[model samples]
Target chain A: MAKKRIVTTTLNGNQTEFLCEPRQTLLEVLRDNMDLTGTKEGCSNGNCGACTVILNGRPVDSCLVLAVEAEGATVRTIEGVATAAGLDPIQKAFLEGAALQCGICTPGFIMQSEWFLSQNPKPTEDEIRFNLAGNLCRCTGYDKIVRAVQDAATTWQDHYMKNCHEKGCH
Target chain B: MRDFEYEAPTTLAAAIELVAKHNGSARCLAGGTDLIDQVRVGRLTPDVLIDVKKIAELNVLEHGATGLRLGAAVPCYQVYGHCGIVSDYAALADSCRIIGGVQIQSRASVGGNLCNSGPAADSTPSLIVLGAVAVIAGPKGRREVAVEDFCTGPGKNVLQPSELLVELKFPARAANSGSHYRRFIPRNEMDIAVVGVGASVVLNDAKDKFVSARIALGAVAPTPLFAKAVGDALAGQPINDETIAKAATAARAIAVPIDDMRGTKEFRLHITGVLTERVLKAAVARARGEHVDCRIGH
Candidate 1:
């Protein structure tokens, strides 16, 4: 085993620290050391987006990232998608749209969709499909997932505008 | 994966020194999308991993009147998302946009792609057609190599043990000139190219004839090859279907593809001709001030 190095990062909304080997991947550190297992690992080679996480506002395959390399970065995983109020709009939309069957690929799909919708609030069907191509869902065949993203986009946009108007910022 | 000492050097000089000390047992990490995979699979066992992303010199992405200087560690998403790069360097943009899925694009760097030296790297043909030069830093000093001549064979390049690819510089395109890249893949996304073609054409003032041209092919040779005969034949010729077809035939003649699982040799040769024609037409359209959606998809 290599010498364990302490890495401090901003995970979700909290500043966190963990001791891990330099060779351990971000996915491994998140799962094993930090005990945040929402980010799943399907194919560790990065072909599948099952280990997706937003690092410093950009989504990346956590399995392909080293723990030491993310020493000072901010990371957001599936576990951070909701708040104390309730489930996020994306999670709500996924449930309403019935976007999962076996549910192994749901976390990654949701994380990726959140990143895409953050960039393009109102995306076309083709854009949604193309943007989410990295995530694979063998059970759902992707039709429901696509609809879920569309639904989330509309719901989230409406909610955002409503909040802005209530707060007198818009 | 093997355990190794990880060093994040803030300066290029320190990185070079670390590599020199480790010699054959060190690997530079910039966008570890590829290197991490190789290490996990036991293909690479470097005793020291030098993280070069912390080095300021390897993280620059600048565009000016002279041209563009893209730091070797700039991610693919950044390359494709830059306004000037997407508009002026269309072929490079096209390649960058489709290098991998969105996650991969956010992490993979074009410099890392070139250094990986894959035979079918999506960026090589476009870089070669754009006349890009790679700036390399080593223990001795610095040197520049044309992108076309950088790779010697599949998985092989001309970098010494203590050398690092610093950045890539591309000259500004001439007036009335445009470049485009296209690749044939079995699936629409997240698939390697079976046959890739990159074409850059500069039309005359009238937009009726080819003033100058360059074409490069990928996945059909050990190293991406320049279709010199095709470019030469198209130069000074009127822009028409007949001339384009002749150039496509010339492109087919120069391809030396092997029979791989992705495609057969005959299929690759035939698709090379098809893609050459399509890519040239698109480049010509762009040169004539026509809008073309060069993004990867149907």
Candidate 2:
């Protein structure tokens, strides 16, 4: 084992610190060191986005990122999607739409979707499909996954609009 | 994966010194989309990983009167998303847009793609057609290499062990000039290109004749090849189907394709001509101030 270095990052809105080897990937650090296993590892390479996580507001394959690279970065993983109140709307949409068969790729799909929606709240169906191209699902054939993202986008838009109205924000 | 020492130097000089110290046992880390994968597969066992993302000079993306100065570490997404790059350098933008799925683009850098030296790298042909120049920094100071000559062979480049690519510089887009890139793939998204063609043309004042042209092909050879014959055939020629067909034939003649799993040599050769014609036509249209989607053939 090489020397384990301390990495400080903001994970899921919480300032966190953990010890990891330099060779360990961000996915490994999130799962093993931080106990945030929601970010699954599928290909372990960049081909599959099952290990997708939002780093500094951009969705990237955590498997391709070194653990030390996440130092001083803001990381949002699958475990960060749902709040203390309840499941995030995207997660809820995935469940309601039955978007997963094995569920191995769900967390990645949800994370990418969240980042996509954050950038474009009212994305078209084509945009949704293109945005989710990195993620792979052996089951469900992606129709349900696409539908789930659409559902989530619509629901989230309505929720955001309502909150803005309450806050007197146009 | 082998454990390696990691150093993120904020200055290019420091990074160069680190690599010099490690000799050939250190690898510069940019986005790590490619390097980390190689490390995980045991293909690379660098004694030290010099993370260059923290180096400010290597992460710049500037568009000025001279042209575009793309930092070596600028992510593919940033390159594609930059309005100036997308508008002025359409061929490069098309290549960046299709480099990988969105997540890969978020971290993959064009410089990394070039340095990776994959024969089928999507960005190489476009960069070559755009006449991009790579700025390399090393213990010996800095040097510039034309993008077309950067890759020596598959998975090989001319970079010294102690050197790092600092940035890529593209010439200013000339008036009445347009560029286009197209690739044949088994799938629409997230697949290696079977045959890639990038074409750029500068039309005469009337926009009916080609004043100058450049054609570059990828995936059909050990390294991305500039189709000089094709460009020479189109120079000062009337921009018509006849000239386009002749240029395509020249492209096919020069293609040295291999029988790869993605495509047969014959298939790649055939598509090289086909894509060359299509890309040239699109480039001509773009040069005529028309908006053309280069990915239409995908």
Candidate 1 Cα errors over 4 Å, as ranges:
A160-170, B295-298
Cα error, residue B267 of model 2, in Å, equals 0.4
Q: Spell out the clash pairs found in candidate 1.
A: none
Candidate 2 TM-score versus the reference: 0.96
TM-score of each: 0.97, 0.96
lDDT string, candidate 2, A74-128, tens digits: 9988887778999988889999999999999999999998777767778888788
RMSD of each: 2.3, 2.4
Tell me the whole-model lDDT of each prediction, alpha carbons only: 0.90, 0.90
Each model's fnat? 0.80, 0.80
Cα-based lDDT at residue B100, candidate 1:
81
| Alpha carbon deviation, residue A25, candidate 1 (Å) | 0.3
lDDT of 1 by residue, A1-170 (tens): 66989999999979999998989999999999999998998999988899999998888999999999889999999999989998888899999999999888899998998777767777899899889988888899899999999998887887645544554543
Off by over 4 Å in 2: A159-170, B294-298
What would the per-residue lDDT of candidate 2 be over residues B51-125, giving only the tens digit for each residue?
A: 989888889999978999999999999998888988889999999988889999999999999999999999999
* Candidate 1 interface RMSD value: 1.0
